[model samples]
Target: MLSRAARPALRAGASLQTRAVLPSSANFATLREIEGRLKSIKNIEKITNTMKIVASTKLNRAQRAMQDSRVYGKTSNGVFESAETKPVEAENKKKLVVVCSSDKGLCGGIHSGLSRYIRREALENPNFDLVILGEKAKSQLQRTNAKDIVLSFAGVGKDIPTFADAQAIADQIVLLPNEYSHIEIVYNKFINATSYEPAVVEAFSEEAIAASANFSAFEVDEELLSNLREYALANSLYWALTEGHACEISARRNAMDNASKNAGEMINKYQILFNRTRQAVITGELVEIITGATASEDM
Candidate 1:
């Protein structure tokens, strides 16, 4: 015969055994949900890793183009450096800023950094007109300074920039009716694999170049001044575009790498949770079976 405490404990076990079916089904559903989420995270990781590889490959070519363009740009500007050229100052003249950014995104803060620099310049001196070379910068600056935009280009930064592309853009800038005291080509400077900063390449007006302090040292035909200014503009623009492309590629690689790492961590955590939950469901079913057998024996 069973004691009073033993009788109550046996009755409670029988009740728990009766309700076990629903709990088991619920636990199984939970496991299924965890599995689905884990699969999705894994897929995301694969995509990010692939993007990282592509960006890394493009980075090398972009850096090489940047180095070559830098040599051409420096050689063109050598005369101005020696002469200590400066922008011709006049009360009526406005400065021109050529902003170089890309249409594509997901490369971290490359676009925002250029926009921020433009904003800062607007605050310090509002006497500048913008000639943007990419949709990214044009879209950003339009929201705040639409009226200041003189021209904007599309289809920029699709691949490694070419000298012909720079020459075409410079031709358009030269055709603008409004005269500028000097031109500033703003772009991202590649510092390292993980670092970049906004920088400017100066392009002087024909008048500014002619007014250079030591201009008399070099004798040249008067007609060549216009040609020299245009050539120098193209060279500077080519340099800016190539350097900006490298910076964008490097930033994208780093961003994708970080994303892949985070997804991997989530997958690991979910996998452990899934295993523990499966074991728990199995243990609960065993307990229920044992309890039912004990009750039958008691009866």
Candidate 2:
């Protein structure tokens, strides 16, 4: 121990040990961070997967309801289609736009697309009022078109819409003091599981229905025209609500599926990174031990 060469060897080993300890501690910290991230990603993956499954289960039911409502709505409006009804061209009259959306999110652009359509329409013809159903669209339109929003409804889309719900909403609309020339029901139309688009279902007012090009062909009593208008509006609203619900379910399923896949990918990458970092740290420790042993042996 007193020898000059032995002293130098000890000093060299001490230096090497110091270097190794510092780097090992830093690497351990890095490894801990990576491990924590991996755990968080794994948890995220589980949640996304569960959501995807739930959406998939609900999709079938929503689509069935949509199909049934579509038929009901079309049958109710068949008379108007046959008569070729058209809204009267009155500049003094204001039109009503009913926007169908849901309170919940995670469906890609379903609500936003409807909002954008309304905004674009506002830019072109600013003579319309909004009757928004659901919180999502209401919140969006309220920011820019607060004055235009005459009515907003909540607690919708919690489940499949019943005809009673639509009827109740129609009754409220009919009671409004501001008479509308015509009402347009805007909703996300379900094209397929992977696709949907904004579409409109027209609900003619009593005046518009009466002014049909072939109104005289039907032996309809003039007294029953108001009741027909109300019934037609309810049918159309129910159809829009069901179709929009189906689209939202499908969109949510796709979105959650994609999220789960992305989370899985991240998890895999992080796991590999963690393994590599752990191996590197262990290797560094082993190398330090070996180097110190060799230096002492030389002494």
- Model 1, span 107-175: residue lDDT tens: 888998999999999999999999998898888899988999999999999999999999999999999
TM per candidate: 0.88, 0.92
TM-score of 2: 0.92
Best by TM-score: 2
RMSD per model, one decimal = 3.8, 2.4
Candidate 2: clashing pairs of residues? none
RMSD from true fold, candidate 1: 3.8
lDDT of 2 by residue, 213-255 (tens): 8988987899999998999999999999999999999999999
Q: What is the lDDT of candidate 1?
A: 0.92
